[model samples]
Target: MPTRPLTCTQCQPKLLAYVHNQLADSDRRRVARHLNDCPVCYAAYLAQREVAQELAGTIPSIGLPDSLQLNRMWLAIQSDMNRPRTIPRPQLARMGVACLVFVLALLLPWSLDKQQVALAVPPPPRAPVVTASLNVTASPESGRRALPPTAAASSTEAVIPAAKTPDTPSNVQDTR
Candidate 1:
């Protein structure tokens, strides 16, 4: 049989088709003859055929598990079913006390008149102190120039007042 010659580029397209038995017999023979003579086409045909066969053999056929949705639903149900039902007793008591205090605070002013409640706090009690006396006398000559008196009792008990300058004598005049 006389064969029509084709380029490597042209033969490549029909190469797989020829191997898979999809091409017309004359076309297949032409491609097959080219593949046998050309190393590049022959390698490409083998790789393509091997890949096609491998892919056909390896495609997944089994379905995913059906329990996935059921597991998710069960978890959700368990979470909802097992949620905490009651607050701790102490917390509940504290909440009740707070509510009561709030209500009392709100109602207290309305229930009491200005005169009924006094806001003034009582002053704290004064601390007690002990007082003792001792007699002391300044010398008569210097007595007339006596120092001021203070709370601190004496040589025996002299109470010397804090120092304050005497007012200017009325008779003194500013000469400046």
Candidate 2:
């Protein structure tokens, strides 16, 4: 199991100063020994030093500002940092239009018409013929011509022949 290191809140302010290289040699030595034994303090010291170095680089390196100039600089830095960055509405609208045009470029060919369907003359209707006789047979023994299966259904008729036994001779005998 791992153990948590003791954090000295009182030491943090001096640690910050020490990390920034603004502390005396005696205080630096004390903080260094404390950091060697305490992993939390060591990490905090390293992080604070890195932040101090980054902040020092970001701000101008001029001499300390007098009261009024310092106030104005702090105010300006705060206001500028706090203000939300925005893409203007007109620019967003223009980008939307550009995207629409690009999509249309890809889709225009599919939507446009090149081939037109010509109008064709309709064929004349066929004349109906009359049948004077109707006859149907039901028994397989009947020699009447067999109608196709698609013929209109009648309660007494069947178009298909009955199943034959396996041993029965076929109608056409093979000569081969």
lDDT of each: 0.69, 0.63
lDDT of the structure predicted as candidate 1: 0.69
Worst 10-residue lDDT window for candidate 2 reads 114-123
Over 14-78, each residue of candidate 2 has an lDDT whose tens digit, in order, gives 77788767878767776777789878777888898888788878874556568898899999999
Against the hidden reference, what TM-scores do the models get? 0.33, 0.30
Q: Which ranges of candidate 2 are over 4 A from the true structure?
A: 1-7, 62-176
Weakest 10 consecutive residues of candidate 1 by summed lDDT: 115-124
Model 2 whole-model lDDT (C-alpha atoms): 0.63
Candidate 1 lDDT tens digits, 68-157: 777999999999899987767898889999999999999997786432233222323344455656445466776576555445433333
Model 1 alpha-carbon drift over 4 Å, by segment = 60-176
Q: List the residue pairs that clash in candidate 1.
A: 149-161, 150-160, 150-161, 153-157, 153-158, 154-157, 154-158
